[model samples]
Target: MTVPRAWWARLPDPVIDAVVVAVAVVDVLLSLVDASPVEQAMAALACAALVVRRRFPLPVFLLTLPAIMQAIVVAPFAALYTLAARSRDRRLLVACVIMFALASEASWLLNDLTSDDRTWTLVNFFYALAAVAVPVLLGQLVQARRDLARRLVEIEEAREHERLLHSQAVLTRERAQLAREMHDVVSHQVSLIAIQAGALQVAATDPDFKEGACTIRSLSVDTLDELRHMVTLLRASGGRASELTPQPTLADLHRLVTTSGIDAELTGELPPGTSTTAQRAVYRTVQEALTNVRKHAPGATATVRLWHADDGAAFGVTVTNTPPTRPSLPLPGAQQGLIGLRERAELLGGTFESGATAEGGYEAILRIPAGTD
Candidate 1:
């Protein structure tokens, strides 16, 4: 129940208990009346028990039962509130309330107030009812609010967990795609280079040139072997696999425009000799960005810009597309394109940014370390 974090949360347990105890002590002294010494002792016990009511709620409730039946002032009301807040057993709370009401009537009837004291008994019954209900109701309300807050927290945690699972699934699919693309594109093209080297090695009649061609062919074979092993060991997720094709580089910018079946323009230039890895990343960034434009903003004319210092210190690629005039292409989308592109750039010690442009277009940019081939 919400007893642990009730309104008295601001006050330490001992301090709140001291306040309650002081109130009960004052209440007892003010309401003292002619009673047997045994009843007086019981009332005193009830007042003292209020200090430990929260710690031992059930025991305190039992201890105060006699004092309540004897009408020992506010001790019984305080006990009832503590019990209602900490305990989930409604039957016990209801039973204690009934006992309190009956005791209120008995306290009046047993007095020497006269035989026609029915009206006074009724009024006292209502007062005792208020005392019992106000605390119990207040405690229950706090309990309900605490439960609601806990449930909301749990729901938010569940949502976060689901998002993580989805991310992991996406990562698995992307890894498989990488393996497939590397095997189908890189290994195949390298095998073609090896075949040409093998032909040159046999055709050349010079010993030095033939030996160089043989060396190139052997290196290509070794690379193909390693690439095949890597791809074979990779785990593939269940998704639509694209047909393996040659990986594009900066040289294929025009082909990508034609491949995307959209009006596109490209300008600027990378450093004279950038690393193959850096070039491939930029090409994929632009390719995916254009594919996204085709998917989300159909009929949008796109512009691709490349920038790099002649010294090859750093280079950047940017693609911006004007607002689409028509609806997007009717192809399914997974929305992971920009996310993957950003990851690719950052993995290479570069930065990537994509957002709506001030001129009412969308732009994706990537900056990576400039290195020669």
Candidate 2:
């Protein structure tokens, strides 16, 4: 089955079929000595049938039975091989092989009468069966080889697709982290610079000093705007770069708690019309806290509370988890979620705090001014 390839493998289908038919004709001619007109016609039919054997293997093989009955083998052998190579039904192929062996001995079986002849016929039947089995086995081997080649190609394609998805996921994570750092650190610092420059410009007595401070404030404000756009683009990196998804807000908190994969309850609500940034900070704080509960405190129940503090100056979210009921795996992590959450809160003029509670539980809280954007 692993034999070196000959030049014939590269031949076109039409050319190969032409060659097969020509060879089958030559075989029929060589075996046609003293053959009757009916036998000659059947042999010619078998030779011609080889041209269409690839497309109609079973029928072509049946067409060669008459020639096989007249003791011609080459045409029948080719037809049986075609049948076995194309057919997927094992029972059908086995039946065809039996039919082929019977056809090869049909003339002798019809005329035999003597007991000695009967014994010889049985021996010839098995011999014919053995001979016909070679093509069937060879045809099956070729089928198996073709199937294996196709399977290997499919596996390689699947692996390539998986690699592409993995690389995309990595790129998305990196872009999101970059966006967070830019929004939380660079934007915050630039805003402060702009605010102080404006303050200095208003207070400066000299005309030159006032002009310089005003120029600095303008540039800082422009840079801060550009950074915001960049952060938006980076956060939306997984899809269209310019398109941004709706940022999460306090209204989404209930759904977040339900889907956080923890036994959690939500208890309080902030007044409506809070700034979008403050709402987002609250949402992220709860999301990160619930994630930690699932990861480090398996089987722990949690409570997420949203409340406006006394004096009505600020609102906040507090997420607390009970002690874990089951041990947790020591899963490796970058430990960036809490840090990111804290940075996000500071960006909104808020505070983030997390700690192990007195009862061996965990708590995370984010408080932001109600009026801040």
Highest lDDT among the candidates is held by which one?
2
lDDT by candidate, in order shown = 0.78, 0.86
Model 2, range 276-345, lDDT digits (tens) per residue? Answer: 7788778888888997787678679999998997788898989999998654445567879999998998
lDDT of 1: 0.78
TM-score of each: 0.55, 0.63
Q: Which 10 consecutive residues of model 1 have the lowest summed lDDT?
A: 236-245
Screening candidate 2 with a backbone cut-off below 3 angstroms (N, C-alpha, C), the clashing residue pairs are none
Candidate 1 stretches greater than 4 Å from native: 1-10, 33-39, 69-73, 111-116, 229-373
Can you write out model 1's per-residue Cα lDDT over 198-249, one digit (the tens) per residue?
A: 9999999999999999999999999999988777655433333333334567
lDDT, residue 208, candidate 1: 99
